[model samples]
Target: MKNNRGLLIVLSGPSGVGKDTILNSLLEKSQNIKLSVSATTRSPRAGEVDGDDYFFLTEKEFKTLVNDGGMLEYAEYNGNYYGTPKKAVEESRALGQDVILEIEVNGAMQIKEKSEDALFIFIMPPSRQELMRRLVDRKTEDEATINARLEVAEYEMSRAGEYDYVVVNEKLDKAVEDIQSIIDAAKCSAKRAKKFIDEVLNNA
Candidate 1:
């Protein structure tokens, strides 16, 4: 008997913390939530489909959206632009669907500034050594890149206190369950149910 608007859940974590793996698992298990697809200037990698993985755009297009104020939040990283499209998020929320935004810490902070009610969740690894192992296992980046990522991860982890919830991603299933529970609990929050409560009191 929930009558409130949908929840905006922002999930962020340091690099190599398995955020993507956890998010993919959570989406596969949950049907009530939708992923907020981001628009990026980076080229689509192999097996990455446009509109599914990302709305790949040219640099010009990305700058145009930014200038037109069409993006909810955007950031430039490694000379590429990435942003959340305002229309998709607004449309999904209007239909009472919870929107899950898997973004970076900086992007999460931007969302917080714009939408204070949004739930922010930060994922953490079991240990720094494990995180390093995970990064090396990927074999995607060079040593220098990995070192840079590690440095950035340390800084991102420092800001974990800014988030509303911190879920340790030691076990995949447990982490997914923890986030699902957080979403359920957030939906039942007093702020979300205020309208119903006020109506009941008025009628009484």
Candidate 2:
């Protein structure tokens, strides 16, 4: 059994940067890393599964959990509440499973304030033009909304320097590979490896 504790990976990126697609691919390639399912008050979108994608909750229920300290981080956006369940993440880490949080900048900042050990990664698009193109291609948002998102993306990208690593999502496969390598390297970091070293020395 590994004596080292699992890592908390907080991933954040601008909208339309393919964060979801990259995360899905990362999970498919890696084992022992679990997605931290967030709880939200918003109605499920098309094909979004409750409990799997998010723990869909009513506004009252979501607020109750937040008030009770059940959430590690919570944020309100577009009149909907979204948060990470504290217990789920704690339990997963206790079992030595790394938890990846695909969250927004606000939520990621909250996590950073709480857990200094957590690994923060910011995803970037190839260019501003490419980001705009991807947002328009989605067809889910109107022109006004797309423009709003682009403005927000520019601001979010400005915060990329705050993260531990910045990955450019030029190629899906390469991005996944890059993040996987980062995770592996993080596991071997001196801070995490020291726990195993201490255990061995004490046992000796």
**Residue by residue across 42-97, what tens digits does model 2's lDDT show?**
99999999989899999999999988989889998899998999888989988889
Worst 10 residues of 2 by lDDT: 1-10
Task: Report how far off residue 68 is in candidate 2 (Å).
Answer: 3.7
**Best candidate according to TM-score:** 1
List the candidate 1 regions with Cα displacement exceeding 4 Å. Answer: 42-50, 57-61
**TM-score versus the correct structure, for each prediction:** 0.89, 0.88
Model 1: weakest 10-residue lDDT segment is 1-10
- For each candidate, C-alpha RMSD in Å? 2.1, 2.3
Predicted structure 2: clash tally = 0
Give the per-residue Cα lDDT of candidate 2 at 170: 97
Q: Can you tell me which runs of candidate 2 are displaced by over 4 Å?
A: 1-4, 43-50, 58-60
Give Cα-based local distance difference scores for all models. 0.90, 0.90
Q: Count the backbone clashes (under 3 Å) in each candidate.
A: 0, 0
